[model samples]
Target: MSTPPTSSGPQLRSFASTNRFLTEIASPSSLRPGYVLVGDEIFLYDRCRKAVLSTLVPEDFRDFSLHDLDLSETSIFEALDRAQTPSLMAPFQVLFIRNIKNLYGRGSKKEEFAAIEAYFRSPNPQALILFVADHIRIPTDVRRMDYQDKERFDRIRETLGEWCGTVELARVDENDAVRWIADTAESRSVRFDPDAARELADSLGADMMLISSEFEKLLLYVEGKNRVTLGDVETMVLAAKQRSLYELTDAISAKDRPRALALLHGLLNASDGGEDAAIGHLYMLARTFRQMLIILEKNVRDSRAIWQALWQGFRMPPFAAEDLIRQARRYKSRRELTRALRLVARADLELRSSPVNKVLVLERLVLDLCAEPKSSLYEPSMQFAIEM
Candidate 1:
């Protein structure tokens, strides 16, 4: 997906380019006397706060509580009454509604829903009713009704559509993510080397919120630097716990016994305060390897499909899927991987039960599996290793 054009200044030109409704208001067109901003991005709320101050409304519109209108306690009449209120100063006022989806369902008071629908049918021209329902789908009636049947909803969409223009914000894919990170880092006056951007994208995955926060932190940490290097990213952005586990897995896969042992030791040191936490990390790593084996056995050829299966079944972090997909390519066949997985499973049990040093047990298991002949029996020994 294409990344939206980054605005150089504070003003934005289109809401269609962003999921944020408030950011759209910063566009010159949306600042008109009457406009309705709708959507479920938190940025929209911040926009409303700015708009309220600009309009100079009494009682500090910023203080308006989301809970003020109780769907159960407040009647539709009361809501409509509020929607119908005239602007305090300007020719038009905004009627902001947060969590509009809450107005749905049989549990909602009938009157409140009716009032909301009616206001949509004939929205006051002098009052702009902004609805923010982030992530929730628009109600069926609202979606299906013709303009005449749902005049207010139609009008709101039309107004927003016009102001937002033809641009629609698309989700950033891996390629776009790399570019976005680079651009964002540069815009903040922080150096974002190409390699650092790629590493950041791989680690953060598709979670935009986390990516943004990390970008900011990295920028601040590396302030005054001309370049954000891979080492900088490793130091500041990488999750130490996750990094060590991933490194341990890589070392095992590559048959690097010493490195694998070192990583295991690192994990142990990090978890010094709690032995259970260390065990849990090892369990998670074993579980990840087990899943990799399953995907291989299923002969899932498509990376995306494998990713979906992993996410649906195991709830792994999205970013990890790509790495797993890459790792899956190393196995010559599902059988080989399955055998290796069984070895790891045994290592898992040994760490838990065997009197051997947990780290030593894990290191030995890695070595043995990497040394195993490609033709070894697949299921029983593998299962035995895990069970024992």
Candidate 2:
């Protein structure tokens, strides 16, 4: 996350609005002597970095002209001086300084700051510098920051604002996300249905990096087809979702406590595992319970009939639908589904509010859902809403 640069030049542009980025900062005319690309979103950051690189270094010149420097091991002056030196063989040189925030550490020298400001004021015409700062909060989400954290954030922003053309690659919100998906699919010559686009956004959260990869997979899955329907999305996308999520739900539905616990541990211990994955899992479980509640309300008994009925209403593939129908049969009454939904709701609230281990909270939730159904803890009025 990067704060907007101080008012002076039109060097800073955000990737959140694609049009603004393409029209303003992405243009060759907007290329600056030095750039500060800030954001935690690695994909967008990399994309913006590449865009700048394209303007600086041509593909053939990359071999001889592109310099990747890590500031952690080198001084700021040395890196800038090296970048300022002309390329031996290529027309222009591009220097990418990784983890640039290291240069602004507590023990940083005044000479180093002077060198940086000097380079910015009169940068080398033959070299373009990209200072990559990782893990800075954008717009400085103050609600999550303490006084010291806020101070550090402001200091970094101010320091970079003085030296480099800052561009923030902030997290993509829902509406922009939907448009991004649609536009990306269209660019790939794949027709993405509007409803399916929204569903993809809802299921995948707002991580554009992950969403982009998944969108590619979806297109490949529906090769030769002009239209990507909700059903295609349900089949192809859920297959990916199943790898991360379905096994845990299946274990719970099957009352296989050991397997469920193992899956839960895997989810919590995996590299990308954390509160976000836990929250996604919780919502999936809640959705499953809600589906079962619908089945119970309609009194659909036979697995075949239930699958057929669900096919009309839900966007799951045949195999997943069959599996869900079988799972729905495990519940003997509406109370069981209602109890599960209530448990899921309570878990959702706890996950968001409590500071306890998120994985542990989810583990407890799994235990409750798989355990025997208990009597109503709420009045009949409240039960109806959760259950049905």
lDDT leader: 2
**Model 1, poorest ten-residue lDDT window?**
7-16
Q: Give the TM-scores of the predictions, in the order they appear.
A: 0.56, 0.58
Worst 10 residues of 2 by lDDT: 3-12
* Tens digits of lDDT, candidate 2, 47-107: 6655655556789878999888888887788888887788779988888888776766778
On residues 165-199, what C-alpha lDDT tens digit does candidate 1 reach at each position? 22222234555656667766667666788987787
Measured with C-alpha atoms, the lDDT of residue 312 in candidate 2 is 58
Candidate 2's TM-score reads 0.58
Off by over 4 Å in 1: 1-16, 19-61, 64-80, 87-95, 98-127, 136-170, 173-180, 223-227, 238-285, 296-313, 322-335, 345-388
Model 2 stretches with alpha carbons more than 4 Å out: 1-29, 139-150, 238-388
